[model samples]
Target chain A: MTLLNAIDPWLAGPRSAELLFPTLALPVLGLLLAPLLGARWARLLALASLVVGLVLALACTAALVAADAPLVYALGGWAAPLGVELRLDGPAALMLLLTAVLLLLIGLHAAGEFSVRAAGRRATLAFWTLLLGVWAGLDGLFLGRDLFNLYVAIEVLTFSAVPMVCLKGHAAQFQAAFQYLLFALLGSALYLLGAGLMLGVHGTLDIAQIRVALDAVATHPPDIGGDARAATLAAVALMSTGLLAKTALMPLHLWLPPAHGGAPAPASAVLSALVVKGSFFLLFRLWLDLVPDLPQLHVGLLLGGLGVFAILLGNLMALMQARLKLLVAYSTLAQIGYLFLLFPLASGASGGPAATAALIQVVSHALAKASLFLLAGRILVAFGHDRLPALDGFGRAMPATLLVILMAGLALVGLPPSGGYLVKSLYASAAADLGAWWWPPALELGGLLSAAYLARILSIALSPAPASGTGTGAAAGGGHILRAPITGLAAPALLAVCALLLGLLPPALFSVMDVARPGMGSATAVAGVMLSALTPSGFWRSAGPVLTVALVVVLFHSAGESAWGRRIASIGRGVAGFEGWLRQWRTAGALLLLFLLIQVWTSIG
Target chain B: MNEAQLYGVCGAGLVGIGLYGAILGRSTLRRLLAFNLVGSGVFLIFGAIARRGGLAGGAQSDPVPQALVITGLVVAFAATALAVALLIRLATVAHEAASAAATPGSTDDPSTPATASQGRGERGPGHVGAGHS
Candidate 1:
């Protein structure tokens, strides 16, 4: 028997082995079936797969809860060290469920947006097929137990996602897609190199096997030899740098805005909400599960520092955007920063709260950001453009869309009764527990900055139209009527509600994240923290700053002729200029290499 | 040094060159080639690692790294193909845009105006001459 088989027979048994295939296979099945079917039929097939996938994900979660252990399935009955394995733990299952829910809603929206009659048969067919490909890749990444397998999964994700960015076949989009592909290619290559080095040292590609070897090396450094340690350190550093590029963490994020903002709205929703998260999830796995012991304070602090930069710079950049879609994309860059904070907070005490906080942030941001993108799409359709300045009195045109977008903004700003609030609070407590004084204030500032940018959008949207009555509503926009289907509107609205209500999820549901990683603290403890902080005083303490900042931002934005406004505008322009410089290929590449070198130095030292 | 170590060093050299090309190459096609170079270097290292298994008294050459190299090659091939296809499409689109801009009154094409405006907005001033350069 293989070592894995001897260690855990249940992993090779039928019960656990049968669970993960459907989540993966269903999407792959849809992918295969999509090309063969007519456009409408293919869309139907894709939606059906997502629906079933969601149910399967839920069922898997239930099974995990019952078993209270991670489900591992050895492919073809060949256990690890010989064959690949798919694992479904709590986080994986949650990711799968999140993917399913968002894709289903986005698919519904896409059905309306890319109906054969509107977007052509071939385009419709291609969209469904590509969407399925992304789904399958995401599922694989979540389930993959082998590092190389995860690499392949990420490539699948990149390949599928790159084309989706330019689905409209626009020149600008093509360029964006090209840039995105190059970055991803570089990322995967580096990741592969690391995995290869890791295999050479540890003699296994399996994450569990590598972890075991690493632990052994930690205990008896001389036995494994210093060379082994150096190699392992280098591998971790290379892998992290590669994943950072893919995750678009701050300076490496040059490719994200254009690619995400350039895609069709539903496509943008998928790209923003799910695609980047796939790589981030893998990075999370690599750091927390595979090499939990290796990340010293400096490494953690470095990552968290980058997170802080991403949050501040991304929010500032978002405030300067003239286009609604680009604004949302920049907001995504900022929200992504919050995820990186987990690296630092996870270093102290139990990793459970920080991990839970990050996951909750992912879920909340995915829903809210997807909702915002969908709303942007609707706005673009209604107004014939998504130019922010021209979007005056938009709230009067589509109050429902405006309301939903506001709800989403509220969640993003970490206001009460929203998942963003829960995430911030969890992060605050985690940081406090760690005695990391700077992180809490950074989180607080991030929320205010998020509020400011959202206010920028809202203030313009809520402004009174000019006397020409040319910008009164959708009707005034060159005679194009807004025929947004109920499903199209409902999809984003429902997502917003879900994001808002996420904080109120049952305490038992929160505990689901603690499965497999019991050190993450119990769900009740996290929920109790949220509950105790849900009082009126607590709500204002959280919501007050956001509201005040948003009001100030709105007033500041409205008084554009004033000197202070111009000064702020110039500063915004300067930040934008700096951001543009950073997005250059050479600059970004240099930054990437510098970061890699720093990571290696930190790890080795 | 052993043959495996020599191969590993060569692989590392290739990776360095590839990274340099990928970072500094002006054209997308050149960058793509650089990416391939990196992929090849990584595979070579894997192969060298496989051969090193023999020195360690494992199998004559480990099958796992060999398998991994093969998988890596296939993935790199796929990525290269995709990048080339995208590059070709980009060329075609840029060519059309350039020609359309050259001739006035070609406004019949609905995509022309949008492309012309957006192409300027999304790209930096340096990249305005991208595909052609």
Candidate 2:
């Protein structure tokens, strides 16, 4: 009876219940229809489903806003601990809307790439089917209220994403895909083990029920026995470790760059921008909602410490990459690091600023990274290769694409009036409120590193073409012109602009971050923090990183002539060597176990 | 010891062995089989948990974990099938690359040499030794 009442607080009127079912169902329907219909019709069906999915997501957001509460729907009127439940809140709605918008635009771009007449019948059919499958999996992850159900959702996401990595069927791609599959399989296995442990201890798979049970155990430990706490902590530790591996946090990120870089452009865009976020969203939910009262401060610090390493090492690795796609892929490794900072920052009294900052960072990075990847695809098509050094004077050939890269780079570097700038300020303020003063300097250094790499690409791009009439030998000999479809360029251009303009959004709109967790961040607080960025002092703070980037670029340009340049080059090679050593299968696997052990020790201690 | 406790210990041992093999397996195929061992261990734990639930109260066994184990089994089976398919595809692709390298007239594919060099450059000699073995 108490368990029944425990669910009462979460039982809201299902105002948007109708909207939730279709968001998941529409994608499944499209995937199902793709095979029955031929290739051309399947592409149309896929696009149609995404458009409808977007509308459904918007309607869900509207319904949630109107009700001012999360919408929870029980499957077949059977309540939790028995039947499944789907919960829709502010964060989930925001992710739904973001996924819908990105997928639709990427779908439009994909329509041209995978057109029946161009990529052949089989590949076209496969791409559409896999895209919709990924959409359904992401939607499932966002809405699932049962921990076991969420595990299934993540598996769905992994299976669908792995095949897309090797769609080209090349040997290198096959190797990348194989490694990706192995890591993901290991992750899910551990996750399943943890879920089983939780079920054994809690007697329920529903997240709400487990939380209620945990609270009960906390209040009256004798009722459930002392071992329950240890079991619960161990279970949470295992689950978190599994999620970290799946999210590819720093040391666990060995599989990401190659898998993401080797995929087709549209696939890379989706993988980098959305697929990784599914596991991250689950991790956030586990820490914040499921085990908020547990002794996790040390765990948070461990994760934040890892974030620092990922930012420094990933950016350094990106700076050394000779291929445009791999550079962008390594940049993803760095951006993922920023997401982990939320754990430590939010662990303090004020979770509001950190939560809002992390949300903004996720949305903006998704947009910018997707745009950069699509643009990389455009460059590949125009030059017959994406080798960075050979891309000199590409700006002259594809001015619009270069412009898009600049906009995306601005967001990546967190320049003023961009989402990156807003996130950095919020992070600094959050760290200040927590009295953790070291984070602001780390964020600034990370921004500077990002700027150094972007400057490398832009400087090379803007350099003059050689005396011959060609920029790249491949482009010159192959006669590949710089003509790309308008949709290909326009789609990425729109996404990059959105990333830059994210900061300009009204502060009141960010109240969604506080939606189920009301004290997380208020509108006024967010407004004040955002407004501070526009101040003269804030403007100067933002300018400092830009100036440092300029200096780094100048140093790099004169590197061949100076002794300082040689020293910096040697350091770069050393970082690359360290990264190479870390990426070995045995090393990464050993690190996974070591991280799991550390996570367990922290949680239990 | 009680049956449930005994099974639980066995499950934990299986998990430890599976983790070791999955991490240090010499080939992708071995790793896939090791993953299956881990899945079996997890399922065994679930079964033991159900038995413990039965000893604690209402029914002969808790139906929920049983139901969960079934779903988990399906997922694991699907995962194995997919991994196997990918392994076969990888083998075929490697064979093709090796044969193409051996053949004299197969230089029509411009991407072959570039891919070969890129693989060597990216993995380094150390990785080639550890990864492909």
Candidate 3:
């Protein structure tokens, strides 16, 4: 290469400008305005940023569809691992578009709605900044071609999410938020440790370069009796475990319920809607860049199996929830389960049919879950309390919100005529294709459990308001008081309607979804689409038997500290001992002493 | 010790301690502080990582992590600020609810809000920050 070729990254490129300028604008604008203006204005600025972002994302998507192949922009005209590169491909562009649209809508709804004062202004500002930071982090992750750059993106995303947890100022939220923050930090530590090893072992942190480098590593006959491979696998395991903690995959999901559930409504919406996906997005990058071309499909299968467990556990817990927020939180865990299926499904070439089906499942789940969280937030806003029992007569009074909830819930349940069903069908069909017919049954069982719990919500929502009308917000003098909620209901309702609409038009989603290269599968893998679409609710009116079954299923799972079960017990202990604990802590001071010890440990260590 | 080695060991130690604190601490404020400690430790780790990146064949410390740490620091500050604000609000809510339930309509009592915001914002929040200690 000539000196001039090395002088600048790319030759006076307008194309680079297109990719760089629009993508960088949001964060730059955030930094510029965050400190200058009071938070109230900062929020509108954030929404404006996302609005611009949404338009840019759509335009980029349009460009990607029109022009095949990924759009690669080299920073400062440099190339490879040495020079930073911004890669925007079809799948990534689509992800960006999804994030932009969801976040823009979230900002729109939140700016007008969440009215905090002293801290509210500050919170609003932080929310906007974090929102932008999260978007940038995620967009960067998807496009990042290097290991080190991707690590930066992961950190940005993690820290951005931390504030959303404690934004509400609830005392309990502090602990919940702290727990999440701590876990996330540990995850980052592990990730860094892994990355450090990789860098030390391999000279370049560029993923493509690493992939090229791996050929030699892989072909080298067993080195040190495969100890080198052992080291690499150890790194991968550490990184995977760390990422799983952030995604709240299963047992590590201890922080999720509190972080997502305890947060205020808009915070909850963002936390559930996009934040979890950020780490999941990094996991996607890890798979694409770091892993061998022919990875062990069993790893993804293991994740999928755990995902199925999450679904069963999540729904059972959701079924048991009296508090509305916790139910939604559990639902989030279950929905996260659906996203995990993507790993197994995306390895379409290995198990061609299953992988192809996994594609459909991922797209559908993202949309449907985002819809569920937003709609649930709207429900909470509508009714002062989000307790299921408290919403006894809510359906009659707030028909529109109830309708949206039902539709979103239906999508969550994987009911027909909704995108969730199409996604489930593809996942199930894919499972069958692998002759892993057992997983299809597991998926169906998950579906049934989901339907049962969702039915619980719907039933409560559908029931007539009692003569007392006391618990539901109607007794609190409802009408104009919950205007923000009325607005909140609109977007999620639209999303739910679109959910069904998308199901009916799979050809269309499949078309745009075409941006992702067909790694290794035929389109026919979606055949279960019809079977799932045609499933009967004939079992619905036989509700008593099925309800009993759901109950038995739920009870069987609820015995110990199912992450959700433990949470409920803690809440109980918290309430029942609130005064006693307070008095005892004051009198005995043991709790205070424990807290002091903890402080000493942290500061000194 | 040089800053690099000192930071690495301190970072690891802080992470271990912070995780312990977060798991064991019952006090909400201590919990929040523990979280901050974890965050600081993570920053230290990132610093160490970036230092490693700098020592590579022909690379400066990765500007990306620098930028990212900038973002993370800001976000962490935001989180800490939110936590402080929330603690104040919780203090106010506790006082108000307790007073409302126990003393009934004693919200007019200035002492309730006093325990919440510092006694003197006129002296400024900077002063109040010091005053809290």
Q: Best-fitting candidate, measured by TM-score?
A: 1
Clash pairs detected, candidate 2: A352-A520
Model 1: residue A131 alpha-carbon error in angstroms: 0.7
Error of 1 at A193 (Å): 0.4
**Candidate 2 TM-score, true structure as reference:** 0.94
Worst 10 residues of 3 chain A by lDDT: A579-588
TM-score of chain B of each: 0.79, 0.80, 0.69
What are the candidates' individual DockQ scores? 0.43, 0.43, 0.11
Per-model TM-score, in order, reads: 0.94, 0.94, 0.75
Ranking of all candidate structures by their lDDT, best first: 1, 2, 3
Residue B45 of model 1, lDDT score: 96
For residues A94-162, write the lDDT of model 3, one tens digit per residue. Answer: 677778877776666666655456356666777777777777777777678776677677777776787
What DockQ number belongs to candidate 2?
Answer: 0.43
Error of 1 at A160 (Å): 0.6
Model 2 chain A poorest ten-residue lDDT run = A7-16
lDDT of each: 0.83, 0.81, 0.61
Candidate number that wins on lDDT, 1 or 3: 1
